[model samples]
Target chain A: MNALRNAALVAVVAVAIVLQAVVLRYVSVDGVVPNLALVLVVVVAVSRGSQFAAVFGFGAGLLLDLAPPADHVAGRWALALVVVGYLAGRVRQDARESPVASVLLVGAMSFVGTSVFALSGVLLQDGALPVDLTLRVLAISVLWDLMLAPFVVPPLLRLVDRLGSDEVAAARPVSLARTS
Target chain B: MRRRRFGQGPTHDGSRRVLGLLVLAALTVITLDARAGDGSPIDPARAAVGSLFGPVESTTAAVTRPFADAISSFRTNKSLRGDVATLAAENSRLRGEVSTDPLDRQRLAELDGLTRTAAETGYSLVGARVIAIGPVQSFTRSVTIDVGTSSGVTKNMTVLNNDGLVGRVVQATSSTATVLLIVDTESVVGARLGTNSEIGFLRGRGSIADSGRLDLELVDNAVVPSGGDVVVTWGSQNGVPYVAGIPIGRVESVVSSPRQSSRIAVIVPFVDFSALDVVGVVVPQGTTGDRPVISTPTGKADR
Candidate 1:
C-alpha cells in the first residue's frame, strides 16, 4: 500500500510538471504561467509532514531544473522548492484543518518560491534580471498561482487524503468519514 | 490530544535534519553545475529527462492545440476572420510565385513563405516544429524543436520562420534541439543596417512584450540611424550562427545617450517569438567533389 501511494505521488507530480511545461504556456498571460508543480509540492507538504514534502520538493525541483528549454543552472529550482516545501510543511496542521488557510499557504509559498528562485538568479547572474521586469514577473506569477489554487488544491487534497496510509486513515477518522 | 497520534508519523527533529541535508545537497549541486560550465555532469541527466518528457510534451501540445486555437479565436474573432481572408489571398499569390520558380517548386510546397525565403537567400533548410517551451520558473526565452542531429541540425545553426530570424540552436539531442530565441538576454547577433551598411551588435531584451523588440548599437557613432531603417544580419565567419542578408527587423526608435558615444536604436524583430510553430534550421550545403577546370585555347593550357 505504501509503495502504491508513493508511486501515485510520483505520477501526480510528474503529470503536474509536464502540464506546467507544455499545456500551461498556451494559457499564459504576459509570459507568466502558473507554477503548478510548486502548488503540488505545497499541497503535499500540507497533507504530509516536512520530511516527505522536502523529499518530494527536491525531486520535483530537479525535474524542473533538468527539463528541456531550461537554460539556467540545475539546482536553482531545487533549492527554492526545498525551502518552500519545508516552510509549507511547518504549517501542515493549520492548513489541513482550514481550506482558507491552505489557499493562503499556497499563495504565500508561491511568493517565497518565486522570490527564492529570483534571488538565486540575481546572485548567480544567470540572466538579465532588471528590477522592473523581475517585479512584474513576480507579481504576475503570484497572481496566476493564486488563481490556480482554488481549482487545484481541494481536489488534490482529497486525493492525497485517499492515498494516506492505513495508520493515517485510522488516526484521522473524521477525514475518512467525510470521504465515505 | 489528536496531535500525539499524528506525531507518530515523523518527529520534528527528523524532519528538520532532512531539510538541512536536502538544502545542503541542492546547494552542492548548484555549485558543481555552475563551476562545471558546459561540461557539467548534470548535462547527461538533463538530456535524459528531456528525452523522456519530449514525447509527452509533443503529444500534449498536439492534443491541446485545437482548444488553444478556439480560445484565441474567440478573443480575436473579427481580426482572425479578416486574417483568414488575407492569408488565403497571400497563399494564392505565394503559390503563383512558387510555380514561376520551377527549380524550387517541389521543395517549396511546405511552409511556402519560409521555403521561398530560404531559396531566395540560397540556403538549404530543414523544417521543424516547436515541441515545448522553456518553463516560466526560469526566465530564459528558448524553445525545443522537433529536429536535432538526426535531421542534420548542429549547434550554432540559424533558425528562422516565415517572417525572419528566430534564434540559434544551442543544444541538440538525437531527436530534439533547443533554440535560444533572439529575444533572450543572452542572445547577441551581429547586424548591418540595410541602408548604409553600418556595423552594429543587436542584443535581446529578454521579453516579447511591447512588440518583441531588440537593442541595436552601432559600432560607429557618426552615422545617425533614422526610424524605419531595415536591418539584416551582418553574417558571421562561415555563417555558423547567422547568414548575411537575412532580414532581422526595422529600427523602431533610437535612444540617444550622452555617456556613450555609440548610438542605440530599438528594433522590432520580424519573427513573432511568442507564437512560434514551424521553423527551419539553415543547414550548410556540402561541397560537391572538386572544382571544375576550364581548358585554355593557348598551347599547353597555361601549363
Candidate 2:
C-alpha cells in the first residue's frame, strides 16, 4: 500500500491525543497514564528514521505540553519528544526478530525520557524526590510506555506505510551495536 | 576470510558509544537531582523549553476549549449550583450563631484589613480560568490560564482564589501564562504561623492522600502556637513574590523526634484546588501597597 493512502494515521494520532487529554486525565492509575503517542511515534519512527521521527515527535510533544497549563518556558516537551522518538527509532532497528526485544527497547527509552524530565524538573525547581516516589513514578512510566508500544506501534506502522509518511516508513531501523 | 556485519552498519559502534555516554550522563543527572543539587546546566534549558512552548500551548487551549467544556460539563455543571446553595445555607447558619461576642481587636483589625485590601487592589476579584492540566498529575505541576504576559502576568506572580493562595507563575507568553500549583513537591514559598509571629518556610508535598501537606521549615518552631496557628505567607521579604500574610492554612498537627531539631507541621491550603475555576494572579503589590491581614473563623490562638 502507498504510504499516503490511509486516513488511519491521523485518526490514530487524534485518538491518542483524545485519550491523553480526556480519558487519561480522568483515570490516573498510580499517576501513570499510558504514553499512546509515544508508542505510535516509536513504532512509526523505527520503520521510518530519526529525521522524520524527530520532527513529528517535537510536534506531538508540543501538543502534550500545551495540554497542560503553561507555567514555565516552552520547548521542553519538543526537546523531550524529539529525543525519545529518535532514540526509540534506533531501538526498533535493534529489535527486529523478537517482539520482547521491542518491549525492552521501548521500556528503556521511556525510562530514559522520564528520567530526563525528572532531572530537568528538579534542576529548574527547588526540591528533591524521595526514593519511593521516584521509583514508583519511573516504574509506572516505563511500564506504561512499554505496555502501550504493542498497541500503538502496529497501527502507527500501517498508518505510515499508508500515508507515505516521510522517510520513516521506507527506511529500516538502524542498529547501534557496532562501531563507526 | 573476514566477515562483515550486514545490518549493523559502519556507524553502529559510534552510535552505541554515543548512546552509552548519553545514558551515563542521564544517570549522573538523576543522581544529582535526587539529592537536590542544581542538575548541571539543566535550569536554563528547562526555562528555554518552557518559554518556547508557551505560545503553542495558548493556541491549543483556544482551539480546544469547546471540547474541554463539553467533557467537563458534567463534573462542573452540577457542582456550581450545589455550591451556591450550600454556601448560602452555611452563611445563614453562621450569621445566626455569632452576631458579635467581643471579638479579638487584633483579629477584627486583620479581617477589616483583608476586606479593605480586597476592595483596594482590584485583584480581589480578578478572575482567570483554568485552561488545561497535564495528562499526568505526578510528572507535572502546572496549568494554563486565560491570562498571559499581555494581561500583565509575569513569572513568580502568585495566583489566588477565594480560599487564598493557589500557585505561582513560572513563565509567561503573550496570551497565556502557566501556573505551577502549590501542591507540587517542588514549590517553595515563605510562610509563617498565624497565631504567633513564628516564621517558617512552606514546601509542597505532592499527595492528596496527605490532604495538601505543606512542609514547614520554621525559624522558631518552638514559638509557633499549637493548633490554632493559622499559616500565612511571610510576605515581609522585599522582592518576595508572595505578599506577607495571605492565608495559607492552619497547622493541622505537629511531630518531633528526639533526633530532630525542627518539627514538621502539615498544613491544609485554603484554596480547594480540585474545584478551582476562577483565580487571581496576585502580583505582589510590594511595600508600596497596603498589607493584607488574615483572620480565622475560630478565635483560638492555641491548640
* Lowest-sum lDDT 10-residue window in model 2 chain A: A171-180
In model 2, state the lDDT of residue A80: 63
> In model 2, which runs have C-alpha deviations exceeding 4 angstroms?
A1-32, A49-87, A90-108, A119-127, A142-151, A161-180, B1-7, B10-56, B62-117, B120-125, B135-140, B208-210, B237-239, B283-303
- Residue range A11-124, candidate 2, lDDT tens digits: 566457545543444333433566676676666556555555665666565555444352332344445666776676565555444566766767776776667666656665
lDDT of 2 by residue, B1-303 (tens): 334333344545655454445445444544443354433344454445445455544455556544333333433344432232343344445444542433335335534544454554333323466655554323555666766655557677777765677788775665566778777776878887776767877877764333547777787747545875788877745524676657788777776655877787878777766545556666422211121222233322111
**TM-score of candidate 2 chain A against the true chain A:** 0.75
Backbone clash pairs for candidate 1 read none
Model 1, runs deviating above 4 Å: A1-4, A173-180, B1-10, B77-110, B286-303
Q: lDDT tens string, model 1, B1-303?
A: 255333344468898899999999999889988989878898889889877777777677778664444434343334432132343344444443433333234235437777577667777677787877875457788888877676677789998887888999987777778899888888999999999999999999888654668999899988888899999999989897888888899999999898886689999998877777778888766411112111123212211
Every model's DockQ? 0.41, 0.19
